[model samples]
Target: MYLFLVLSLHTLWVAVSIAMQHGHYDMCKTQTKSDEGIVWEYMACQPESRDMTPYLKVKLEPPNSTCGDPPEPFCAMGNPYMCNNECDASTKELAHPPELMFDSEGRNPSTFWQSVTWKNYPAPLQINVTLSWGKTIELTQNIAITFESGRPEKMILEKSLDYGLTWQPYQFYAADCLDAFRMEPKSVKDLTSSTVLDIICTEEYSTGYATHTKTISFEIKDRFAIFAGPRLHNMASLYSQLDTTKNLRDFFTVTDLRIRLLKPATGATFVDERNLERYFYAISDIKIHGRCKCNLHANSCTFTNNRLACDCEHNTTGQDCERCKKNYQGQAWSPGSYLTIPKGTANICVSSMPSNCYCYGHSNRCTYIEVVNTAVCVGCRHNTHGQQCEKCKKGFHRNGSAKLDDVNVCIANICDNELLRCQNGGVCHNNMRCLCPSGYTGILCEKQKCEDTGSCSSKSGQESVSHNLYLITMIIVTRLCTF
Candidate 1:
C-alpha cells in the first residue's frame, strides 16, 4: 500500500510539472535566497488558457433572428421530405435559445440555437453571433464552432480590440473563396511567418455538408506553428517573435469575437425553394480557449459582478493590467516581455518613493521627464540629487571618507545662503565655512568676542559658566556636522 501511494504521488508530481512547463508564466513571483534573505523575484506572468465561452455574453443581431417566434417546422439538411422537427418558443423541450450554443454538450441528440429559416430566400439569410468578453483576452487555441444543421457555406470570423468599437476580419470561410471574399484560398498550413497575419478565405471547412465535418474552426495553433515549429515544441521561438512583434501579439488579442454567418449550406448547387425550413443556421457549440490579456503582469483572471477582470500583480492595476498603479509610476508603464525565456522580464512598476527608483539607494522617488526621455530622482536623500541621485546638491559636498552609495556620502554645507547663512559681518567661503571678522567667533560667526581683558572679566563675573563649556561646544559642533 505504501509503495502504491508513492507511485501515485510520483505520477501526480509528473503531471503537475508538465502542466507548469506547458504554461511557463503561470506564476508572477517566486521566493529565492539572496544575500539580503528570501525576497520576491518577479517575472512576466499570464493567466492559464481556459474555456472562455462561459465568460462571454453572446448577442445575435436582428433581435428576432432566433426561430420559433411563431411555431415552425424544419427539415433535415440531407432530406427535404423529413420535416418532422417542430420548434415552439413556448415549449421548453422544443425551444432553442442563443445560450444553447455555449452550453455543455455530450447529450445523445445535441441541443442547438437555430436561427429563423431562410423563408425569405434570395434575401440572403445572414446572422451575426457576437461573443463579448467585455475585457481583453489572448487566444491560445483554435476557435471551433460546431453546427447542428450544417457548417455555413459562407462565414466570416471577425475580432474587435476596442470593445467592439471597430472590427477587422480575422478569417474568411467560403465554398468558393474567390467568389465570396474576392481573396485567394489559403489554408493555415500554407502560411509562413511573413504571411501569418494575412487574412485569407479558406474553403477547407465550408466545402462539405458531411455530418462529421460539422465543425468550422479559426486556426490559431497552425499560425503559431509558423514560428514555433510543428507540434509547438519550441514555443520560445514563437514567444520571442510575439514579444518583438506588436502586430503578431495584437493578432491573438481580442475584446470581442463575431461569427458572421452569411449563407447556409445547401446539399446541392442550388437552394430548393420548397424546403426553406432546412436552410437555417443552427449552432450547437462554440469553443473559445483563451487567457485574459493582463499585459503579462498577472497569472489569474476572475469573473466577478458579471464581468471578467485580471487579478493584477507587479504593481499594475487595470482590467487588463495595462497601466501602473497610482504610486508605482516611477517609470513609464510598459508591458512585460516574453523574450528572456522561462522567466521573462517583469518590467514591474517601481515605487514612486525616491529610494525605490533605482537611484543607487539615495532616493525613493523618481519622476519621468518626457522632454528629456529620462527618469530623474525626486527628493533625493543624503543631500544627493541628479538623474540617478548620483550628484551632490548645491551648498553640499561629497564626503571624501565614504563611497557614493553611503548614506553620509553627500556632506551638508557649513554655511550657505539658506539655513546655514553666515552672520556678524562674516563672509561665506565656498559653503565649507563662515570666515568670521576679528571681533566675532564661532562656526557661523554668531558670537561676539570679548577682546579686552577688562570686558572678559566683567562678563565672566556677571554670568556663571559651565565647567565643561569647551567639551559642550565641541559636542554640538560634531553633532551639527554629522548626517
Candidate 2:
C-alpha cells in the first residue's frame, strides 16, 4: 500500500497541452507493476501529484521558449520556439514556461509544443537528469519507467551507488504480452486520451496519411495500457526481468540516480507543418519500492542513509531475511516476508522444498544436528571421510588419483597382510577363504592329518622272506620256553 514517488516527466504532446491549460500535470498516465510482475497503467493516474519534487534537479539546460499573445504571434527570424507559452485574455500578457520538463503548453495547436530542435546541431542531443534522496535508500527488485512523449526512439538507464564516479547498466524489466493479456484489469478507465495511445497511433504516421481507423478496433479489444505493448494501433506491452541475478535491493543503498536519452523523438516531416522539424522527448514518471521501514526494529535490520537493511543471520538471505542461503538448503516461511495475498491478483507461484545436507559416495554420511548451522556427514561410505563425505578414510587407498570428482574411488584392505593368500599351496577366495589339500586342513594348511608309508617287493622274494621270518619266530619262541 505504500508508494514511493521518484521522477515524473509527462512527455506526451496532448498531456502537455492539457497540463498547460490546467494548473498541474494531472493529464499524464502512470504505470504500476505488482509483485507478480503484472503491469497496471492508470490512464488517469494523474501522478503529477506524486512527483518527486524535492529530489529532482535538472543537470542540463534545455532549449528556451516564451509565452506570448496571438498563440502564434508572428516572431521574426533568429528567435526560435519558446519552451512554454500561455496568454492571459484579461491583460493580453504572456507567462513564462515552468522550469524542468513540466511546462508543455505551446502556441502551435497541431504539434503539442515547439520542441527543442537539433536538426543542424553538430552532434546528437542528449538529456541528462539526476535524482537523489539527499540520503541513501534501499531499492526494490525492479524499477518502472513511464514516458509521455509516446514515441521517443531510444532511452537507456544507468545507476551509480557511489555518487556518479562509476556507473553500470541498469537492467530494464523484460516484458511480454502473451500471458499478461488475460490478466489485464477490467475496471481501468478509458485510454483514448492516454499518452500510450499517442505512441501507438503515431508509429505509422506519414506525410499524406489521413485518419487512423485502427483506433476504434484497438479501443474495443478490452486492452490495458499497461498490460499490452503498443503495436502501432493495438495494446500496451508487458515488461519483466527473467533470469536476473540482481534484484532491486541488491544495490543495498542508492545515493544517486541518472537517466540518459540516446535517441529522442524527431519531428515527423510527414505531419502538418506546425509539428515539422520539432524534435523532443519526455518521461512521465518512475516508481520504486524498497525494504520495509518496520524491519529496522522488529527484524534487527540495520539503518543506513535513511534506509533499512535486514540483518540476515548467517545461512539465511532474502528481502526479509527469511529464506535459507545456498548450501544450507531449506525452505523457510515467515509472516514478515509476505503477510497476505491481495484479492484478484495473479501470481506465478514457486514451491518451496525442505533443506537437507547432501553427500556423494560416503566419505561420511550426512546427519542433521539441531542448533548446528551446517549438517555434518558422519558415517562415510566407500571408505571415504570428510565434512562433505569427500576424502578417503585413514586406512583406505584412493583409486585413480587424477580423477578429482570420482566419489567411489576409495579401496579398503579386506584381509591381514600375513594372510595375503592361503599358505602352503592353498587357494584363496574373497581374500579370506582358503581351499586346502585332501589330507591337510588348517587356517593355512600347516598341520598334517595322516602319515604316508611304502609297499613290498617282488612276489618270490616276498614268499622266501615270509618263510624265513616264520622259522626264526618259532625258534625264538622255543628257546624262551626252555629258558
Candidate 3:
C-alpha cells in the first residue's frame, strides 16, 4: 500500500518535470539583499533572472569527486562547474542527473522522488543543505534520512563548523548501528535475511554530538548486492534520550545549517533492467528535529535542565513562547503564541467548559467522577459519557465520531432476545452473543459444566481424546435409537 502511494505520486510528478530539471544549488536567484541576517524568502518568491552568475549565488561547495571520465568532473545541470564547458552534452551523459530531493514548494508537499544519479559511480555523492531560523535553535536534536529502501549500507555522519570548507565525522562517541535493532526488532531479527536497517544513535552515544560541527555530512558505505537492504527511519530517534545534552545552542553558533551527502569514491554497482551497470545512490527525505525558532518575551530567558526555561506570561508558553497557554487563545502574531489580546484579561480557553455533566439522551442524569486528575462523566444516559452528553460509555462500540448536531447515544448490547437470552445471569453482547457465567457452558449458557472434569476449560485448552470419543459415542447411540 505504501509503495503504491509513492509510485502514484511519481507518475504525477512527470507533468511538472520541467521545474525539477534544475539542481537546487544553481536554481534560485536572490531578489533582494544577500545579507547574513536577512530573512530568506522561498525560492519561488525570489526574483528570477538568468543573468545571475554562479558566484553571486549562495550555494555550498560542490563535491570534488563525481562520475564520468577524468580531466573534467561531471555534475547535474545547474550545478557549479569545475572547469570550462562543464555541462556540455559532449562532455556529459545525454540524460541529465536526477535532481536532489529537499525543501517543499508551495501547494505541493516535499518532492520525494527527486534524486541525484550518475551513470557511473560518483565517488561519493555530497549534498550540503543550509539551515535557517529567526531565533537560534538552542538544541541540535536529531537527524534522520529516508532512503529508497532498507538496504545494507553504511553512511558516516559528519559536521563542519566553518561552513563546508572543512568537515569531520561526528565522533563524540562511537555509534553502534545495532541499537536501532531494538526499535524494529522484527525487521532485523535474522540479520542474515534482513533487507532494511534504521540506524539510531543509542542514548549512550549521543552525549555531545552537536559540539563538533554545524554542518551535518553523511558518508554512505557501499554494501554488496548480495546483502542489499534499504532502510528508512524518523529523525527524532537519532537524538539523545537525555534532553539536557541534546540542546542545539550549547554548541557553536551558525547562520546556515548544511547537510552534505557524500557518495563514496568507490561503491557497489548493480545491473539495471537494461542490463547496464550503474552506480547510483538516492535519498527520499531528510528530517531534523529541534525547538521552534521564535523570539519570546518572558520573565527570564535561560536554559534549565537542558530546556528553555521561560516564565512566560499567563497568555503565552512553549519552547519559544510560540503558543498560548490553555484557557487563553486567539489568532497568533508577533511572538507567535495565541493571546487573549488587549493585556490578556480574557478567558478564551480552547477546552470546553466543565459545566453540569450530561450523557447522551439525558441532560441531568449523569454524575462526574474524578479519575487520574481529570473529571470523568459516568452513569450516562443511553450508555454514553462526556461533558456535552456525547460519546459511548465503556464496553460499548462507536462506529465513528458524532457529526455536528448529532446526538451520540450507544445502543444496549443485549444477547439474542427472541432465542434464549443467556441463562444463569450470563452477559449478552453483539445483539445475541452470550458471555456465559462460570460453571456453565453452551451457546446460551444453558449447560451445567462440571469443574472436576475440567469441562469449564477455556476454548484454547487442549481437548483429551477420551472426551472426543465420548461425544462421538453419545451421538451414535442417540441416532441408533431414533432409527
Candidate 4:
C-alpha cells in the first residue's frame, strides 16, 4: 500500500506541473525537422507574472512625509481618547519607517508606515508615495494598498510610461467623486470592450470608516474581464485582441506608479480642529503583481545590479528585447506576435548571410566580397544596388511615395552627368530636373530659346557652331581613350 501511494503522488505532481505551464510561455524555441534537417522553431513568449513589490524602490515626497522626525503623539481614528501611540525616528521599535509598508506582515502587532498628524488643520495634509521599477512592466492583477488607518477620503493613483517623465491617472478614490474630481463615480464593472481604457473615479473603497474595510484597490483583472470573460477562461480571445490592438496592449504597461494623497479620512462632515492628531494616513502594505515587458520575445526576467531586465531571445537585444541584434538586420525588426493562438509568431530576425543573399526581394544573386567580409548583391534588378540592394544606383533617386521593395522605388534621374546630361550650361537640381541658363529651354536644356520661335540670328548661329564643336571634341576624346 505504501509503494502504491508514493507512485500516485508522483504522478499527481507531474500533472500539476504541466497544468501550471499550460498557457504560460515557458519555452522560447523547440527542435523540429525541416528540409535542412533538424532546426530550431521559435515562438512568441513572455515571462510569468509575479509579485513585483520586492523589486520596486519606494520614495516619499515632501521629503519628510513619514512621521517620527521629532517624536510625535497620535490618537486612534475610532477613539480620540486612546492617545498611547508614539512615533520616534531615533527608536527602531517606535519609528514608523517607509520600509515597513513592504515588510512581511503576520506579527502580533502589524508594522506600518505612518505620516505625521494633521496638526495644521484647514490646510491639506498631502503626501506622495512613488514606486519605481526602472523598467516597463505589465499589470496582471489588482493593485491593493492596505491602509493601517482609515482609507483616505480623496486620493489619486497615477501611472507613468516614460519612467516618470509624465503621468496619467489610473484611478481616483473618494467619498464623493463629483466633489473631489468633478466626475461621476463608476466602477470597473461598468466598463465594456469599447470603453475598457477609460479612467474612472470610484467611491467604493472610500465610504464610511469600517474597521475591517482598509484595502483600496485599482482593478486590473476587472478591466481584462471585459474581453477575457468573467473567469478569464477565454484567454486566447484576450490575447488576440492584445495582438491586434496597440493602444489596448499599452493600457496595462507602466514604468512607475504614484499615490497622491490629497485628503485624509475625516470621519465626520467637518474636521475636528480641536483634535487634529486623529486625522492622518497610515499604510501597512502595498501589493503589485506584474511581469517584465519583454515585447513577447523572452520567457524569463532576471534582477541584476539592483535592476530588473528581460533575458532576451530570438536574436534580439535591449532591456525589453525591443530591437534586432547586430548582423541580424537582414529585415526590419518587428515585435513578436500573439496571433495564431497557442504558439504565436516569433518574428525572429534573420542574420545577414555571405551567400544566398537577402536583398529585400530586389535581387536574387550576390557575390561574397573578401574585402568587406560580407555578401554584396550583384546585378541587382529594379535599378537598386548596394551590399544588400537597399540603395538606388547612380542617375536614379528613391521615390519617396513608394515602398523599399517596390520596383518604382528607384526612378530614373531627369538630369544627370551620364546619359541624361544637362546641356547649355544647365546644372542638375536635386537630380529631379535641370536648372537651365537664361538662353536655354526644353527639359534637358537641349533646345535653345531662339529655336522655340523659329528665329535664328547670327549670334544664335555662332552659339550653335560652338556647341557642335564641343560635342565633336568630347566624342573624339572618348574614342581615343577607349582604343
Candidate 5:
C-alpha cells in the first residue's frame, strides 16, 4: 500500500509541474516578469503588477514636438522660417516629428478597448494624429476631430480603412468630412466576420503609410467602410495597449497647427513634400479604442493627464467615457462613468445645467453636443431667451445693456419694440435666428453683413443655411414692409 501511495504522489507531482509550465507559457509575458517554482508560482506574476507607474496628469504639449519652450535648432534673428519651422540656420522644412505620449498614464495593465482624447488643443492651419487598437478584427467604432487649420480653405483628413495595408487620399474641409463621417449613433456592423469601421487616421509609417493626404478624400460614409483611407496601423493588437510612462489620454501628437499658413498644398503624389496641408478627420479628435483579446464585452481603461490612476470601471475608458471597462468601468453590470472632456474648460460643461448652462442660451447647444458628444456652455441667463442666450425679457428690451444679465425691466414702452431690434443690421426675425442682412452668418450675426444670404435648413428652393456654409447656419428671414 505504501509503495502504491508513493507512486501516485510522484505522478501528481509530475502533472502539477507540467501544468505550471504550460500556465507560464500561456501567461502574457509581454509586459510582465516571469519566474518558476511551485504549481501556483506563475499566478503570482499578474499583468496588473507591471502596469504600475506614477504618471497621471501632465501638460498638454502641442501636437508637434517643435512647440517646446526653447523651440529646437534656433537660428539667427529675422529668420521667420527658422524661428517657426524647426529649420536649421537656413530654411529647411523638416517634418515636425509628433510627440508620442509614452508613460504610465498610457499603459494597459488590466481591461481592454480603452482609448484617449484631447480637446483643449485648438484647430490650426494643419493638424493630424494617428492611432490604432486591437488586431485586424479589433478596431470597431469611428473617430472625428474638429480643428481650426489657420487657413479658411478647408481641412485635410487622412485615414486608413484597412489594417494599415493600403492608403487613401487625405481629406480637406471639416464641414464636408464631418458631415460625411459623422457616425450613426450606436451602429452595429459584423465586426468579427466582415468589415469593421476604419474611418480613423492612424499614421504609422512602418507599414508604408505614405501621405495619402495628397489624394482627395473619398466620399463620406463609404470612405471609412471596409476598404479605403490611408493604411497606417500594421498590426491590430499592437495598437490597443498603452505606455506606462506617458499620460494615457494624450497618446498621440498634433504635428501641424498651421492656422497662419495659406491653402493646403495640393500635389499629385503621396509624400512628405507632396503632403496635403489641410484636414478634418472621420473621427475628429474623439477616438475610442477597445481590446481584441477579450470577447468584445468589457470596458477599456484609460489614464488622464499621464496618470493611470483612473479605472474605466466596468466598460468605460478614454478621457471621455468612450469604451467601458470590465465589471467596474466596462461591464453592463455596472453603469460605469460617462466619457469626460479631455482638458481644461471646454466651452462645454455638462453637469452644470439649468443655471449657467449654455443650452439655456443657445438653440444649437444640444446639436453641438450631438456633433461632438461633449459638454457645451449654453451662456444663458434670466434676461435671455434666444439660441445665443442673448436677449432681454419678453417685456424688457436690452435696457441700455445688451448683455445676458445686464438688462433692465421695461417700465412702459420705452421705445418701439420693432425698430431697435438687432441693432447690428441683422434681420430681426422672431426667435433671434439673427441673420445679418446679407453678408452675415454666426450665432449673433457678429461676422459680416449682407442683403440676401440664400435660405437653407428649410429646403424651400431659396432657403439658405446662412452661408457661405462654414460653421453655424443661424439665420432668420423677415418680410420687408415695403410701402
Candidate 6:
C-alpha cells in the first residue's frame, strides 16, 4: 500500500504520481492537549497488515427509488478494486522522513498504513491515496474524506448516511457547496487497529455522491508523517479569517529540523542543556477533495503567505476562499458561511475543542455572528471584550478604560444570579442595574448582540422599553436552551 498526504496551500489544480512511496509504522507514542487554543498532540497507530479489498468493496447500495422521479442523478455499484498486498518495504525508505523536516527528528514509530481507492463510477476514473505510519497507531475504524478538486464548476458529493445502505446528494457547508470534504478510516478503539476505510463512489451519479458525503471530512492529521527524515512533532492550531469574505486554500510544507541534547546551566540547576545533533523532518500535505462549483480545473485555489484563497471573485472556497463552506473568522459568518466537527468523534476517544468566545479580560459583552452557534463559542459571564469573552461590555454609559468585568450588574433579571451575565454581549439598563441579554452584552449590553442587533424600541411611546426588553430577553433565553 502506498501513502500520500496532500495539502493544498496554493495553485489549486494538481496531480502527482511518484514511484517511491515507502514510509513507516513504528515504535513510541505521545499525545498532549492544552487549555489554550493551541494543542500539542501525538499518537501511534498499528496496522492489521491484512488485505482489506473485500471489506473495502463491502458496500451498502441505496434503497429502491422511493419517489416517482428520484432526482437528476443516480448511483450504481461496480466491481471491487482489489488490493493484492501491493505494499513493498523496499521503497519504504521513501516513507522515511524527508532529508529536511522539523519537530520530529525523522523517526516514525507507529504501526501499519492504510490505503484509499476512489472510483468515479461507470469505470473511467479513479484516485488512490495511502496513509503514513507512526510509532503507535491510534485509530481502528473505517474512514474517508469527501474531497474533490478541479476549477469552480458546480461539483456535487454524495454518501450513505446509513452506513452506506442508501445514498443522498450532499450540499457542502453551504459555501456554494464546492469545497472539499473527507473521512478517515474508522476503527473501534478496542477493536483491531489493522483495518481499512470503506467508501462508496460513483461517477454516474457523482453529483449525488457529493451530496451523500456532505457530512464527511477526513483526518487533517493522524499517526503518520508524510514528510520524514528530520520530521516529527505535535503542534497544530486552528485559525480563521478576520473577515468571512476572504479566500483560503489548504497548503502543506515540510521543514528541516535539528535536535541537540542539552547540558545543565550553571545558575539554573534544573535547566539542563546537552550536546546531540539530530535531523528533523516534517510533511505537510493539503488535499482538495471537494469539487469546485466553477467547473474550472482543480488547481485553481491556493494559499498565499498563510492564507487560503480561491480563484473566483467570491468563490468562498479555494485559494481566495478555498475554505468555502466554513472559513474561520473572528466573526462567525459575516457573509453566508457555517459548519461543525463530526459527531462520530465527539467522545473523549476523539476530542472536542472549546467553542471560541470573543471575551478577553472579562469583557462582559455578548455578540453573535451569522450562524455563530452559541455552542461553538464560550464567553465571559459578567464582563469582558474581544474573543474569548474575557473583557467587559459597554454598559449604562460607563466610560474610562477601567472597564467592568465579571461585574455583578444584572442580579435577578438575566444573569441567572450568577453575578456575571451579559459579559460583552449586550445589556439592558434597569433599576440602577443592567438587564443583560444573553445576546446583548459587554459592560452595558449596548453592543447589539446578534449579527443584526434588534432595535430595543420602547413600544410606540408607551414607555414599553421594559416590555420590549422582556420580549427580547425571553427570545434570547429560549434560543440558548435549544442549542
CA lDDT scores, all candidates in order: 0.86, 0.37, 0.35, 0.86, 0.29, 0.26
lDDT, model 6, position 262: 12
Residue range 109-218, candidate 5, lDDT tens digits = 21111011111223333333334322212223332222111112333343343533544433334322334345232222322213232333221111111223222222
Residues 39-66 of candidate 4: C-alpha lDDT, one tens digit per residue: 9999888999999999999999988988
Candidate number with the higher lDDT (2 or 4): 4
The predicted structure with the larger lDDT, 3 or 4, is: 4
* Candidate with better TM-score, 3 vs 4: 4
In angstroms, the error of model 3 at 39 is 36
Candidate 2 residue-wise lDDT, 1-483, digit = tens: 123222234335565554433222132123567887866432211112222333333343343322222243322111225434333222323322223233332533222222243433446656655555443444532444434343344343456766577775442111111222222222213344233222122122111111221110113122222333343222112111101213422333455666555444433422223532344443433444443322121224454655434444333455444454554442232212111111111111122222223456342224444465455666666667776666676545566653434654765432233423344566655444457777544554433333122233356345545645664565466458645
Q: What's every prediction's RMSD, in angstroms? A: 7.3, 21.7, 27.3, 10.2, 30.7, 28.2
- TM-score of each predicted structure versus truth: 0.76, 0.32, 0.25, 0.75, 0.19, 0.19
* Winner by TM-score: 1
C-alpha positional error of residue 454 in candidate 5 after TM-score superposition, expressed in Å: 99
Could you tell me the lDDT of residue 357 within candidate 4?
31
Tell me the spans in candidate 5 whose CA falls farther than 4 Å from its real position: 1-96, 100-130, 137-162, 167-483
How far is 357's C-alpha from truth in model 6 (Å)?
11
State the local distance difference test value for candidate 4: 0.86
Query: Per-residue lDDT tens digits of candidate 3, residues 289-344?
Result: 43323322342444455443344433556655556665333223234211211111
Let me know the TM-score candidate 1 reaches against the reference structure: 0.76
Q: What is the Cα-based TM-score of model 4?
A: 0.75
Q: Supply candidate 2's per-residue lDDT for 195.
A: 30
Go through the candidates in order and give the clash count of each: 8, 31, 31, 0, 109, 208
